[model samples]
Target: MKIKICFLLLLFAFSNSFGQQNNFNYKREIIGTNDQWHKLELPNEIFGKISPNLNDIRIIGISEQNDTLEAPYIIHSTEDQIKNVNVDFKLLNQSRDKNGYYFTFKVPTSNSINQIQLNFEQENFDWKTTLEGSQDQQNWYTLVEDYRILSINNAHTNYQFSKLNFPNANYGFYRIGIKSGEKPKLESAALFLKEIVKGKSRNYQIKKINTIENKKRKQTELDIDLGSPVLINNLKVNILESFDYYRPVHIQYVTDSTKTELGWKYNYQTLASGTLNSIEKNEFKFSNTVAQHVKIIIKNSDNEALTISNVEIGGSVYELLVRFSKPAKYFLYYGNTNARRPNYDISRFSDNIPKSITTLALGDEKIITKSETPKSEPLFADEKWLWAVMALIILILGGFTLKMIKKTDEREV
Candidate 1:
């Protein structure tokens, strides 16, 4: 691990050195106490008020004036770790007070130090901090001006060199002051910080906000371009499942079809008990009995784009005339086994073999009967009937002759 870290550092040094000018500048950071200063604990008070001692800074609570709201609480790290990191902060509001509850921390630093980077969670309130850098402890330069506001909870803020940089000298000292903007009534604010690397790290801050605001400026902004409205021709079918109309499909309709507007819709009332509807989307539910196929032509009156899903049908073809000012891709999903299906393999339908025919070894009766039939004999060539007729004539003639002979004998007697 040590070797790997060293290798990574070397790689970074080499790569960064080529493209960017290397500030071979490495300086010692100094941490001070009223009695004696420690090298590890720089910026004695982070955002002022709280002790530089890691333990004391961990748990600090601020009280507001005559408002009956709960106060914000802070928790610091244990002594054993220099990289003392705070994890969670819970703000409990009881009664409203004049000033909203908040906490502050003081950070000690070296006089030679230029800037500090702060990574924090909880962006509700404006975080304010002031820096005073000193060498002899007697004279100090107001290194950081005003307070910084960190907005958008679970985010980070970068304080620059100009605001937090100490005066030019060998030895330096600094202080960090913090305050929250919870109005007269005691609102609550909770936050925590993890120290990544303590050095002359550069900060990319929003140009509009001053370092004093302590309000964090983010590096990335979410820009949504809602596309044009699209017409949807969707059909739904219950395959291999016994379903009747009365199952409801929820359609989540949003004014702007973007990531932000993505939400859920339920069709509890529309779906009758014992009925199972497969259509699942936003909020509006469709009845299975009334409509098997539904066509929706969505036009965007709002300048934003529109998206649709959870189209329901009763396994039938629905003809839809879709008008689209913009290009859109339609996503259709079918439920196969109570599970979302796209499982229908196209290859399964490609076999042309008729259903009546079997590919297995089962003998085909139709083919066997046709092949086994013997050829019929011609009528003239059959001798059995002619022979039977000849025998019958002979017998009749013999009987007549015998009868006459008997009569002649009788006359002689």
Candidate 2:
């Protein structure tokens, strides 16, 4: 019958374009902060007012503990915060090149240096450098233009480093640009005194494995599952070749309500052995708590058990404080994907949300301030009963096309 009247007018035009749209907006911007909330900027196009109503929206996420912060400049990392500063270097002249070798140093300072630490002992690979500074070495100042120097030996690990760090200076003449000619034997070129400190922001949110029901419990314990209960420091282990030598591993976790019956309650102990700087990052750093189950007891120190590669978990990151006020324009209105995380006291900012206090984007649903919110479901979710059931389905398809034109005028009488 005309394809059921064209499929009921295309299902009432796709339910009036997705269930009679009400209205909600999303385009957020207005992320500026510092004073140690750590630079997170956008600085333009500001608009926020909350009127699509519903008690003023509040569903935030990204470890949503509330107090709406935006970003910590997407987490900075050149991996630094070095401290081995003793200072004392004076080589002053050396040059050789076919691929590498150039030196001229003197880091005699009274204070005001970015940072430098080049304790060499080559032959392993990866090098690239160029560093310059001068208080009067005839006026020069480049200070690391593409710096990278690294060395590593196998059989489990051996190391050398020079990630060429820089950014701060008073200059007492410094210059070293060894583009890896592999003649590195220069031992002491240290001048460290740099500390950036901004820790509490961990990232690595999912990894759950609870399969091993038996097989002698997968032959001696191995469960780094973290599906919930997080706040960790570090643990990135993925070994194969049967866990490449060097043993002494005993780490355990799972204690929140302290579940028993052989489930969650591993007390808590940490100890890792071998290859720290000589690298193996079998990554181990602990003491943060709130776990979902992380136990890898490979004691008896070593041997054919720590095999089967895979065990990666990471967490512990903070500093996402967003409270900007100068020429504002902020946004981050979550999609209300179910919503549940509202303990807002603006998230107790231990003192530092005053860049002159000014914010407006109060939305995350459920902030109605009273009145209207009890239509009590049904009646076609009333919009005047959805236009009276679309006018009684167009008058029952126009009374069945006028009763088929009165049966063709009674068959032409």
Candidate 1, which segments miss by more than 4 Å at Cα?
A: 1-111, 154-171, 181-413
Poorest 10 consecutive residues by lDDT, candidate 1: 359-368
Which lDDT values do the candidates have, in the order given?
Answer: 0.28, 0.51
Report the lDDT of model 1 for residue 404. 70
Q: Candidate 1 has what TM-score?
A: 0.17
lDDT of 2 by residue, 347-410 (tens): 5643545444332223233322112111223333346676676678778877887898899899
lDDT per residue (tens digit) for residues 135-174 in model 1: 5557766655554433332322221211222333223334
Q: Which parts of model 2 are misplaced by more than 4 Å?
A: 1-3, 12-102, 105-121, 124-133, 138-150, 158-160, 170-173, 176-391, 394-396, 403-413
In angstroms, how far off is 134's CA in candidate 2? 3.0
